[model samples]
Target chain A: MKTQSILLKQRPEKTPQNSDFEFKEEEVSTPKSNEVLLKSIYISVDPYLRGRMRDVESYIEPFQLNEPITSAIIAKVEKSEHENFKEGDYVLGHLAWKEYQVAKGENLRKVDPKQANLSAYLGILGMTGLTAYFGLTEIGAPKEGETVLVSGAAGAVGSTVGQIAKIYGCKTIGIAGSDEKIDLIKGKFNYDEGINYKTTDNMKEAISKAATNGIDVYYDNVGGEILDATLQNINRNGRVINCGAISQYNKDETATGPRVEGILIKKSVKMQGFTLQNDFGEKFNEGTKKLAQWLQEGKLNYEETIREGFEKVPQAFIDLFSGENKGKMVVKVAEE
Target chain B: MKTQSILLKQRPEKTPQNSDFEFKEEEVSTPKSNEVLLKSIYISVDPYLRGRMRDVESYIEPFQLNEPITSAIIAKVEKSEHENFKEGDYVLGHLAWKEYQVAKGENLRKVDPKQANLSAYLGILGMTGLTAYFGLTEIGAPKEGETVLVSGAAGAVGSTVGQIAKIYGCKTIGIAGSDEKIDLIKGKFNYDEGINYKTTDNMKEAISKAATNGIDVYYDNVGGEILDATLQNINRNGRVINCGAISQYNKDETATGPRVEGILIKKSVKMQGFTLQNDFGEKFNEGTKKLAQWLQEGKLNYEETIREGFEKVPQAFIDLFSGENKGKMVVKVAEE
Candidate 1:
């Protein structure tokens, strides 16, 4: 059997270009004993993948040049020689971009389609939900009556963060790039107020005006001048969860901003950065349980901007940099 | 009695100048019931006072034009009508720069000269020691065998941080402005190595060379390019304690540096800032107890650069910007 896969043709200098990726053809190998032949159903494209594209040291290793890119993918088992997995069963794992691949059954987590939609496994019920849950609850620690501000307010983690902050009984404010995104977060996600960064001239003053009381927790998914503006309006003992810096991910040179130590000391704030895999070790089950409970009770909501076809995975990831996705961005390849 | 006092003549645009202060003569008021006429004996001049001189709001109120400058002072009770204090007793309080002033006895803490040197109350056994102790143990949280780096390693808090890190069984590296200060930190304070940032062309490379292994904990007192340099060499799961920003305190405008969120998230680091007052409410006794025990056990040592005379207080403070004093800068006003 044959399959098509996308590989990192070249590392990006500034913003990622389509030329950075290459589509290749490869023969799918037969499953060995204790291994399963899996078909990729849905693929997840995230902003953090940009960091892994660079040749640098981090919690996660950089992607090797000319190798297939890997991310969270929902797959279906077509043939299983292992006891844990059966044919036609849906599963999720950190798998490659290939349409069909063989993997050991133990490396994949069995996901029941009845538990949630198969596409949902790539988002709300999986990594996206976990990132929002742990990043907000563990670091943000929003308290009732406290003001919570979120940047990248319409993206996968940001939308969930705004909703979770509201559930904690806190007044939530969001900063997104578009007026439409602002409306979505405020109307559907229960954010008390929203500021469109592209339209607003003075974010610091705008954030100050919207927050009124002051921001006690800031879930930072888009870091740049917005983070600086939020710092200007942060209250004493504020917590800043550095989940992602989507704004800086594509810059050719490292960006410069106002020094933070002066403000951090003056406000006694804690700015901590974490990736889901590195910081979420040994606690995924706990986070998954809470997120599932919130979803089951209707206290939580999720949005997936799913693009169809396996060949469009690269373009789907490229669209993330342009603010083209509303919520969770996932690509659907096949029906489970 | 006639006494002199220094008042805030103007708000400094950049570095504080002698012209920013005005000396005025005032008649010493006689003690009333529950009041004590205290004569200033020793005064503390710290770098954080630069922040108070600005017209902006901070953790503490900013200084007002024409108001008397105030700081930690050890004074002698010249005339007392209060139950807690008597004539000739030494007391410590956040007092004015006046040679003699009337204050309520309850506002002051009585200090015994027999227990320690009068200046020790202003530095080692006082705010300076507490700042280093809590800033390191609470935020830095250095574990045994870890590598700890201190910027402004010869300053009061930095010197103490280097020593405390050594006491914690961690490898310590010190960064200072001068070679002599570097020698003092390494030879006297027992730092494993030293980096003279002033002469070193590249601080990041120098820090990497000195640390050998990447930096595990960074106690930041001098926040500027050094902080930016330190971030480049931080290890996985590291902690950055922002104690003071002396390098930035005198700047006319806010300083700009490389944005840290990307590095912080990549390294899973925590950057926290605090002051002695806001973060330490009821925990003073706990910190003071541990610090005093180390002093008594000969496990700790302190450096005090004592300048004599009363009228030199303003100059002593202005000199803090140029890095004039070695460890804790204190001025002696009168003999005990």
Candidate 2:
């Protein structure tokens, strides 16, 4: 069978342009023993993909030019040679920006479409949801009655972080770039308070107004001035869970370190950064199960801005840098 | 009877000059009910005294001009009107820089001269010892076989920090200003290794060499380039206990923030600063009892650079800024 894939034509300079990615057709081989051939349904576009465009060392390796960008994808198993998976099983795996591909069945997990929408398998029931779960509960250690301030609060991981904080009985405060995003997050996610950082002249005062008791957990998705403002409002013994620094990820040079880090000394604060892959291995199933339960119970809500076609994957990824998406950004390759 | 006292005449512009202090003679009053008259035997001079001189908000209140500079002192009771203390008993309390002080019995804790030298009570058995114990164990959280690095390694808190790291079965590396202090720390305290940071042009290379396994716990006493270098060498999941930033304390303005804090994201490091007073009320007895036991077992060693007379207290305190003294600096006010 023929499969269409988006290959990196050139490495990105600053923000990625659509011309950097080239679409190519390739042959999809028949499934070998314990392998499956998947037809892609949805491809996830995350902010961390920006880090993979650069040559610098990070928790994960950078993507090479002339290779297809790989990410978590929800797909349907068109052919299976594995005992655990059936021919028509819906699965989730690190499927490249391709319409179809042959993958080892062991690398893919079967997704339950009956419990939740299949598209969610690429988002809240997938890596994005797991990232928020471990990053908050383990690193942030949010206690009941604590105030949790999440930057990028309208985005994929940040939205989930705020909802989880609420589930744990914490007062959730969110910071987003646009007033519309802020309103959606505050109104939809039920965040106790929301700040439009782009409109606010004084971030510290805005944070202070939202967090009257002071922030106990700061889930930093944006790590520039917003992080600096959050630091000033952190109470004694506060914890800062740095899941991503999306603000500085695409910059050519290092951004200035936050001036208010001195608060870390005064408040005896702890700042920790982690990748979901490092913390949750086989335990990702545990996260998905709980997230599915929450979704079925109507206790959690998520949104996705879907760009059509596999060829648009690179543009979808680039849109994350421009803050063009409201929630989890995904490229839909095929209809359910 | 008449007693002599030293007072802070003026706040120093830079290094404390002789005119910064004034000596005065005052009448010594008898002890009231539940009070004991103490004749100063040994007065501790520490780095924290510099913060007390400035009129700034801090964990402890700043010292007022024309008032005696006060700190922890080991004294002998000359007369007692308290049921808990007797004449000739040795005690430790916060006493002014004077030959004699009438203090409430509740403020003094009895010290044994037979178990350890009286001067050790000021350094290894007092607040400095407690700072090292709780800061390392509570904040640093050193694990067995992990590499522990301490700056200002020849000073009271740093020396005790290295020794306690050894007790905890960690590979201890000490950083000091001079070769002599490094030699003494390694030879006397039995640290795994010692680095003379003053002589090393490349502190990053020196730290990398000393901490070959990478630093797991960084007990930061001296903050500046040394702190910057230590941050570069910290392993993943490293813990930095910010007990003091002696390098930046004497500066006129806020010291420049560290450039390598970006490493916090890569290494997932946690840097937390604390004053002993914050944890003293709860962990005081536990820390002191452990230190005393270590002292009696000959497991902990302390060095003292003692200057004679109450008149030398200000000079002794000033010497700390210059890093002239080797271990704990103290002034002998009178004979026990």
Candidate 3:
């Protein structure tokens, strides 16, 4: 049998283009002992992948040239030689951008389609959700009656963060690139206020108006001037959780904005950054259980902008930098 | 009796000059029901005082126009009217830059001169020491074998920070303006390495060479290019303690360096700033007792740049900006 895969063809200088990826067909072999043959159902395309494209040392290893790009994917087990996994079970694994993949059973986590949508395992009940949970609760630590301002509030991790902050009894303010995002976050995600950074002339002034009590926690997803502007309104002992800097991901040079050390000194602010495996590897089961419970209780809501077919995976990733997706960006390859 | 006090004659635009202060003789009044007559012994001149001179809302209120600048001072109770009564008892209080003054008994904490030198109460065994202890252990939290890079390592807080980090079994690298500071930190403060930022053409290169491993903690005292330079070398999960920004205090404009939000995101670093009262108001006694214990165990050593006479208090404060002090900058006003 044959499976189509996307491979990294070239290293991008700035923003990645469709030409940077090459689509090819590869033969799928029978699963070896302790391995499972996965039929890919969905593949996640995240903004953090932009960092993996560069030939630099980062939180994770950079994707090597001419290799099939890999990420979190929801797959069905077509064949299994491992004792832990069965042939008909649905699983989530760090598999390739392909239709069929052979992965070690240990790398595959079984998911229940009955509890939540299988695609959610790629998003709200997965790494994206956990990033929001750990980064906010552990680092940001928003308190009741405090104000939390989340940048990129319409995206996967950000949307979850704003909702969770709301659940924590914080007055949540979201910053997004468009008015649509602002409305979605405010209306559907339960954010108390939303500021459209694209339309707002002065973000600092807008935030000052929205967060009248002053920002006690800043959950940052989009870094650049917005992050810089938010620094102006942070109250004493304010916390800034740096989850991702999507605005600077495609930049040719190292991104720069207003220096923060001076403001940090003045306000006694704490700004921290983290990735999932690095920070929450041990707490994954605990985090996912809580997230699942939140979803089951209908206190949490999630959205996914899914592109159909395996051929569109590369385009889906490139679209992330342009702010094309409302929530988690995923590519659907096959039916369950 | 009349006592000489240095009053703020003018608010400085940049670096404070001698003309900005006016010396006046004020009548020392007898203590009332809960007040005590205080004779100034050792007066602390700190970098944070530079912020108080400006008309800005900071952690502490800005020093009032034409009012005597108040700071940590070791004083002797010349007369007492409270039941807590003590004659010839040395005390520490937020007293003015005056040779003699009256203070409420509630603001005074009696210091035992028999335990350590009365001057030590103003430096290592006092607020300066406590600042280092809490900021380092609580925020910086440098683990064993980690590399700790401290800027302005020859100053009061920086000197103490390097020593405490050394005691924690971390490799300490210090950055200071002159070769004298570099040598002092390396030799006396027991820093593993030292970088003379003023003499070094490329501070990043210098740090790269000295800190063979990436920096795990950055104790920032003189924030400017050095703070910017150190960001490049910070390892993943690094901690940056924003103690002071003496380098930028005299600037006519808000100081700006390379924006740190992006780097902070990439490394998952936590950069935090604090003042003693803002962070450790309730835990001051606990921190000081631990500091005093370290002093008694000979696990900690301290140095002070003592400028003689109350007349030099303003000059001594000005000198802090010019990098004239080796350790804690204090003005010795009276004999023990």
Best of the candidates, lDDT: 1
- C-alpha lDDT of all candidate models, in order: 0.90, 0.85, 0.89
Output the better candidate (2/3) by lDDT.
3
lDDT of 3 at B35: 93
lDDT, residue A283, model 1:
98
Clashing pairs in 2: none
| Candidate 1 lDDT, B1-336, residue by residue in tens | 999999999998888999999999999989999999999999999988889999887999998899998999999999999999989999999999999999998899999999889898898889999999999999999999999999988988888898899899999999988989988988878889999887999998999999888999999998889999999999988999998888899885568889998888888899999878879856999988888888888877778789988889989999988888899999998988
Q: What C-alpha RMSD separates each model from the true structure? A: 1.2, 2.7, 1.4
Model 2 regions more than 4 Å off: A8-13, A252-254, A258-262, A280-290, B6-28, B54-56, B252-254, B258-261
Clashes of each: 0, 0, 0
Query: Chain B alone, TM-score of each model?
Result: 0.98, 0.96, 0.98
Which is the leading candidate under DockQ?
Answer: 1
Give the C-alpha miss distance for residue B74 in model 3, angstroms.
1.3
Instruction: Write candidate 2's Cα lDDT for A1-336 as tens digits.
Output: 798888888877778888888989999899899988899998888887877777766667888988988988999988889988987799989878889998998888888889777878777877888888888998788999999999999998889999999999999999999989989899889899999998999999999999999999999887877877787788877888887777777665545553333456556677777767765666877887888888878878998898998777888888898789977899888987
